[model samples]
Target: MSFCTRFAPSPTGPLHLGHAYSALVAHDMARAQGGSFLLRFEDTDLERSKPEYVRQALDDLAWLGITWDAPPLMQSAHLGIYNQSVEGLTSRGLTYPCRCSRKDIAAALAAPQEGAPHAVYPQTCKTRSMVERGAGDAVRLHMDRALNQASAGLGFIEDGPLHCGVHPIDPAALLDEIGDIVIGRKDIQTAAYFLASAIDDMRQNITHVVRGVDLFEFTQVQILLLDLLGHTPPRYHHHDLIRDDDGKRLAKRDDARAISVYRKDGASPDDIRLMIGL
Candidate 1:
């Protein structure tokens, strides 16, 4: 298959140096193989995603000389697809409705167990029957069943080298580290990041996933979801994250580092590329 990659960015804030780096890297990778590159807008977070931000993000990418195949795919416009996916999982008994709020989860995980994240979920609603599942609840995939399916004689071939941190193609380690994660948000009917992303990748037929290392852990969840949903897992290359002088990851709130601000300061595309070492 021809190489296919995407630079999916949420339109919740202005694009920053980190966004530029990720876009350029994915663009270069696709161009190197004479493949296709797609631009996807991850606007599932309705509370924050704005039309102005979406326009600014597109402008930033174009200013950086990154061209996509067609108009970008916006997550908001695909709510029906996401709903269908959720229904599929729910109907198959692969997902259970979660009613626990943030405080409830926090209180439950007061004591963290070994090998679990500090904000580990105690699965308070895991055993709740479908009859009690309500519209206000979030959908959580059955991790144990998904993992069992993922490890049940599953394998795939990568066209190129797999480079994600220190480990090399350690699928077992990836699964063990990443437990059950949210696939659908309670507040929003739209799919959560992992679920929407996996579905988008599959629908777009993305051959490789290029993003920052911060998302490396989430890849395990994605891989498991794709396997359970009968979709091919794309080859992944989780690059090092862009950090500030204080060794902190760049965030959308860093207005000073936003690409729009840089543009206003008359920074050229080459300047942005140089800044991100592209």
Candidate 2:
């Protein structure tokens, strides 16, 4: 396939320097490969995503001289597609309704057994039968079952600073570590970040995925899902993140590091490139 990559951002807050760094890196990668660059909005969080944020983000990208090949793909407009994916999983008995709240999960983790260092879902709803399941409950993928159904030793290639090679997916480690991750949010009636983004990447024909290193681990889960769904995984390029003076990753809440704030203070786009070491 021809090289195709995307810079997808949630319109829940202002565009921070971290966002700019990721977008610029993806844009540069596409341009260098003489390929297509695409823009997308992960605006599924209806409560937080606003029209103003979307408008400002578009302006910021334009000001940075990052041009896309096509119109932006909005996540909200494609809810039906994600719903269909969830339905497919549900029909195949690979997903189960989860009624466990955050507090319920925390309490379960707090009463954990010895030798368990981290807190993961205790699979409280794992045994619930489909007939007993109803709406208004979050849906979780049966990771073990899904992985078993997929081809053996599933994994993806990483082209990032931390891990730059092919890492095979270990079903045992995933089951003991990540557990059954929630993929369908009952409140939103849409798939979670992992499911929605993975499906969108394949649907959009993304051959190369570029993002920050923070999402590297989640890529494993996505690759598993893509494989189960019978789609080819893309080459992933995870870039370094922009951080604050305290060495913490920059977030949307950090208005001081927001791209709009920098632009308002008369910082040129070149200055941004220099700051992020682009």
Highest lDDT: which candidate?
Answer: 2
Off by more than 4 A, model 2: 112-117
lDDT of 1 by residue, 86-204 (tens): 77777777778789888877766674553343554667788876567777888888776666556454544333344423323345554354545778888647789999999999999
Task: After the best TM-score superposition of candidate 2, give how far the Cα of residue 3 lies from its true spot, in angstroms.
Answer: 0.9
Cα-based lDDT for every prediction: 0.80, 0.88
| Cand. 1 Cα-lDDT | 0.80
Best by TM-score: 2
